[model samples]
Target chain A: MKSNSSTVKTRPTPWDALVFAAVAALAVLTALVFYGPKARTNAPLTCVVSVGGEVMDHVPLASFAGEHTYSHNGYTLTVRVSGGQVEVLHSDCPGQDCVHSGPISRAGQSLVCLPAQVVIHLESGTDGPDVIVG
Target chain B: MKFSVKKLALCAVLAALALGLSTLENLFPVSLIVPLPGVKLGLANIVTVFALYELGAPEALAILVTRCLLGGLFSGTATALLFSLLGGLCAMGVMILLKRSRRLSVYGVSVGGAAAHNAGQILAAMITLGNTMVVGYLPFLLAVALITGTLTGFVVSLLLRATAHLHLTNQSDYR
Candidate 1:
């Protein structure tokens, strides 16, 4: 005698297909919008550093060739400028996200350290956008 | 059709379980691991999945709302509460619609719900921050949602299989 049991099916369904398509579309759209190429210029670049929403220092990327430390509100961020690029070398923030954000040399690029309330942006001669979507 | 004392009691228990899971998940230093501000394992979603299947949509929504409120009050900030409320409502809505359709397995419905949850939170963040830059995080958040949702759905499926004869829901009346 065979015992009866309800078996749960594990096959893919139409709904699964729809979800895959939707997620795929969203991924593609986000990549296009955020990772797409921006207008590049040869204008002189400067790194603008702000702490707690107040501008603290502005150093030209070309002039700064070593590490610069910014401390505020019991937090410290080590920013390194090398080869015309600026990057967060280290941060005391628990998440360390700013340090992992890599380097930025392009105009309009920014690295924000939320824990320390630090915002570093590379600006060019051209006026930046009124509002950067990302 | 009628609310039974047993159903109410079960819902209350489930809500408590969900709140416990929510609080427990908060103890982990997830931000350090994920490097995202609001990302988490969302372990409480397990209870939401179980409620959706064992009780019904309305019951599941009740559990979701109650858990979010209590969890917020217990170990979260006002902004966290706002995000969780928005995300929970959107996720519950998606899961209910998908479950009603009966075309998707629990896994698919769970994934859809999780993705919708992230979308809702992203929308909330965009509104609060007054910048579309928040939208940049959507892709990463959705990817994480898919993974965590699948895990939660798998757990729910196992529970459903093990308790098939418990008659968690009045199938004839509700489903």
Candidate 2:
């Protein structure tokens, strides 16, 4: 402690509301983009599971069956893949967000487990570009 | 940006405090309670804000950088450090600009910083995961940051008030 006296004359201002409102609006717009509909396509969907930033599996949703257990960072996830849908039936991760996410069937939807650094998402099974320039 | 003995000592303390706060926050089952991925309340920001206001930009930046490095090591992975460092820098940048503008209260600055922090983390996640599905989690993270940031701001103000008598610095270099 300096014990010299005086300082911290600054106080919180009313602009706090403005900043909160702006961030709130931005969050809503982004959430819409996240869960919003995507362009319809006939390409088969693939369930992609990535761990530690490595692609562990890219199984075609319809063809895949049964549960696969992945262990990472001392946590394990039992992922159930069937009926063209992917779900985390159980996980040892503390958050259990992947399990709570239920299941994802649509392309671009993901179930993330941060503790395990696992990502499960749906994408076009083809892995081909829609358009190629030049 | 010469570091006086007092300033250096204070910066060290603040950096340690920030690291401690963040580690303490991790002890809570916040992720389990919130069910949101990569959502941290960023409690360490209290120390950052304190340094930014009481000390100057340079000192605050030093503390932040040190905390990130140490935090990364403590987290047991490079990726955790990457996200934490990026988020911390972005949050500190926003808070610095907002504080300089003097147009917003401490709460506004904290909220803005929190928002920036969330954005930065999501950006890191997107790049590392090689996909955009994580982007959908943005709004949820920011929404939560709004509430948490406001409270962080309020706490900073209280901290400033309580420490007003400590005389950390006789000169104000905040701006």
Candidate 3:
């Protein structure tokens, strides 16, 4: 084989360095956005459940103490609301991505089931912002 | 265009290698390490980078599409197939552009491809979930893509060097 000397020179060129630096900058900005401070609220938690873009049910976290199941078109989603938190306890979706998403407790947080077209968003009050302009 | 027997054989071998690497990667239980759904090491990209450099753009695309289809059939669901198709196509497009530009090395081309793959996957997720919030995962995915893409690119560089003497037919046609 030809001497592997050519491969040794495959060091990062100026262009490579520029690209890496740009990506690093993006990473830092994204990290800031991802780990940035959030608006905190002390009001009672309300979980809004929607299916097919229509509001299906609304439950106060403090009042809900047990598991609630919602079914649509043979697909089932079990939601648990307890201790001021909401989560998808179980789902019959093929990937179970919803169930694995853990829980949502803070306002503006949401749990979505794509297969079932279900979305559950946590809010502090019923009259709060429809969309959190961040 | 007519492919010579040698070129055809090489393409088949590269496609098989890409498929094998993809399959082997799926068996590793990577979720334990990454803890994020749909994150992958993208090992098959090694072969892709090799094919891009050695066999040219069109052949590399052929290898990529064939491997994705077969890999999807073997060990993935329909959703997985969709994600792979989108991701692979995006990656291939970026790699071809970078390679043709000749402004960056193979490593840069691979990194570009990997990042594009992640972007494509995020786009797929956003559309599938009907939620724009899915884009929140972009930074983490891009970071992972940088690491994995660089590693795969480095390996391809090594492979190209080691087999530099192999004079396959029509190798010079594209260059």
Candidate 4:
């Protein structure tokens, strides 16, 4: 009730308390809308790790351009990048969210296809998130 | 209740503008591959946010419903309509909540709405496909959501600022 009063004063009356309750309820409901059946179980997620001596400076289309692969959940993605442009050449995942992403060229540009558990991001600048060892 | 031709006309005009902006955002052929399903800039949500704060829930919903239904009909493929409905409803609900909390200005509402829209769409896709692999893309989608959401939020905030004085009177009954 106190929160309601404070909210009312801070906000407007035309949009009232019941509206607030309903919205909160909706937020919870939406968050709980999980997909996939628990019965079948999910495939183990496996991702390839490439450790570099130095941080990536730019889009490495030349070095990793031929083909790149990533596996997660139940999907696998194979991508091709040429001359600083990238596209999903093949994917085992259905719905083709990866194939639909087309390509990425800019330094800050990124393409993520959820169905295939693949992400292609162009690393910017010389410095990036630091890796720590215990 | 007397009919206000002027009010209806204004809503219709805003709805049209929203629809037009939505179509324009798709013209850019640039696509980035992120590990996410159906990621988008959500430029159209700016208009929905504007309609909500400048008008009210019902009017904003009217704009949102019309835009989602018609926009889908015009540019969307099969199953896109379903995704659009889920996205639009999620966006609207977020906007209304943020507006009530006073934590969201028009711009904030726009950002929240856009983020929610993407989340809703991804959820729909996952359900249809019966896959949890899609969930791995959630983080990447959130990243795009942040960028586009902020942009749309800033745009709608500007719109609300220009029309702050205009409010729906008792006779108009935006409720």
Best by DockQ: 2
lDDT of 3 by residue, A1-134 (tens): 12223433355677876566666667666655544554334557787899878998887778876798888757899999877788898899897989998988866688999888899987667544423223
TM-score per model for chain B alone? 0.92, 0.94, 0.94, 0.84
Q: Which is better, 2 or 4, measured by TM-score?
A: 2
lDDT of 2 by residue, B1-175 (tens): 6687878898999999999999998898578878776667788988998788878678889999999999999889999998988888999898888877656777888899999998889878877887665666788889989988988888988887788777786454432
What is the per-residue lDDT of model 1 for residues A69-110, given as tens digits with 9 covering 90 to 100?
988878999999998788999998898889888998766679
lDDT, residue B123, candidate 4: 74
B1-175: candidate 4 lDDT, tens digit per residue = 3326765776798889888887886675325544343666677787787667655678778888898889889975757777888988988898688777664344445556766787678777767776443443454555566567667766765665555445432333433
Model 1 alpha-carbon drift over 4 Å, by segment = A1-17, A38-47, A51-53, A57-85, A88-100, A105-118, A122-134, B172-175
Q: Which candidate, 1 or 2, would have the higher DockQ against the true structure?
A: 2
Question: lDDT score of model 1?
Answer: 0.79
TM-score of each: 0.76, 0.74, 0.71, 0.55
TM-score of chain A of 1: 0.64
DockQ of each: 0.29, 0.38, 0.24, 0.05
User: How is the predicted docking of candidate 1 categorized under the CAPRI scheme?
Assistant: acceptable
Off by over 4 Å in 2: A1-12, A37-44, A47-103, A110-121, A125-134, B172-175
* iRMSD, model 1, in Å: 5.2
Fnat values, candidates in order: 0.27, 0.68, 0.31, 0.01
Worst lDDT 10-window in candidate 3 chain B: B166-175
The best-first sequence of candidates by lDDT reads 2, 1, 3, 4
Task: Write the candidate numbers in order of decreasing DockQ.
Answer: 2, 1, 3, 4
- On the 0 to 100 scale, the lDDT of residue B124 in model 4 is 76
